[model samples]
Target: MDPEDGSGWADVSDRSHRIDDEMDRIVERLRDLAHTQRRFQDLLDAVMSVGRDLELPVVLRRVITTAMGLVDARYGALGVLS
Candidate 1:
C-alpha cells in the first residue's frame, strides 16, 4: 500500500480529530476551575471583610450583603436585636 493512499490519510485525520477533541475538553476543565477559584476567592474576601469589623451591625451587614452578592440576589435581610 502506498503511504499517500486514502487509508493512511484517514488514519492521520482521525488521530488529529481525537487530539482536538481532547484539547477542547481540557480547556473547558480549566475554565471551570478558574470560575470556581474566583468564587472561592470572593467568599474568602467576604469572610475577611466580616472579620475585620468588630461592631455587630457592620458584621451583620457585611454577611447579608456578601451572601446576596455571592448568589446574585437583589435582596437580603438581617434582623436587629433589641
Candidate 2:
C-alpha cells in the first residue's frame, strides 16, 4: 500500500488513539499511587509522633489529634472504659 493511501492513514490514526489511551491510564495510576504514598506517609508520621512520647496522656492526645486531622473532623475524643 502507498504511504499516502487512506488505508495507511486509518492505521496510523488507530495507533495514535491507542497510545493516547494507554498514556491516560498510566497517568491515572501514577496519581493514585502518589495519593496512596502520601496517605501512608501521613499515617507513619502520626504513629511515630505518638510513639516518641512515653507519657500516656501525651500519647493519647497526639493520637486523638492525628485521627481528627486525618478524618478532617472538627472534634475528637478518647474515652477510657473502667
Candidate 3:
C-alpha cells in the first residue's frame, strides 16, 4: 500500500489473512507429523519389548497386549491354525 493515500490497504489485508490461514494449516501438519512419529516410536518400542522375552508363553501374551495397546482396543485374542 502506498504510504500517502493507503489505496491498497484492502488488498494487503486480504493477503495477510491468507498468509495466516496458510500458516495455521502448516502448523496442523506439523502436529500430525509429531503424532505419527510418536506412534512409530511406540511401535518400535513394542517390538523391542516383545523381542527381549525368550519364553513362548510370555511372547504370545506380549504380542496380544501390544497389539491391543497399539490399536487402543479393549479386547484382543490369539488364534492357532494347524
Collision count for each candidate, in order = 0, 0, 0
Report the C-alpha lDDT of model 2 over 1-82, residue by residue, as the tens digit. 4676578888888999999999999999999999889988989999889989899998999999999987889999999999
Can you write out model 3's per-residue Cα lDDT over 27-55, one digit (the tens) per residue?
99999999999899989989999998899
TM-score of each candidate structure, all chains considered together: 0.85, 0.83, 0.88
Q: Flag regions of model 1 displaced more than 4 Å.
A: 1-4, 79-82
Candidate 3 Cα outliers beyond 4 Å, as residue runs = 2-6
**6-47 in candidate 1: lDDT tens per residue?**
687887889999999999999999999999999999999988
lDDT, residue 79, model 2: 96
Following a full C-alpha superposition, what root-mean-square deviation does model 3 have from the true structure? 1.6
Give the candidate number with the greatest TM-score. Answer: 3
List where candidate 2 sits over 4 angstroms from the true fold.
1-4
User: Which pairs of residues collide in candidate 1?
Assistant: none
Query: Candidate 2 — worst ten consecutive residues by lDDT sum?
Result: 1-10
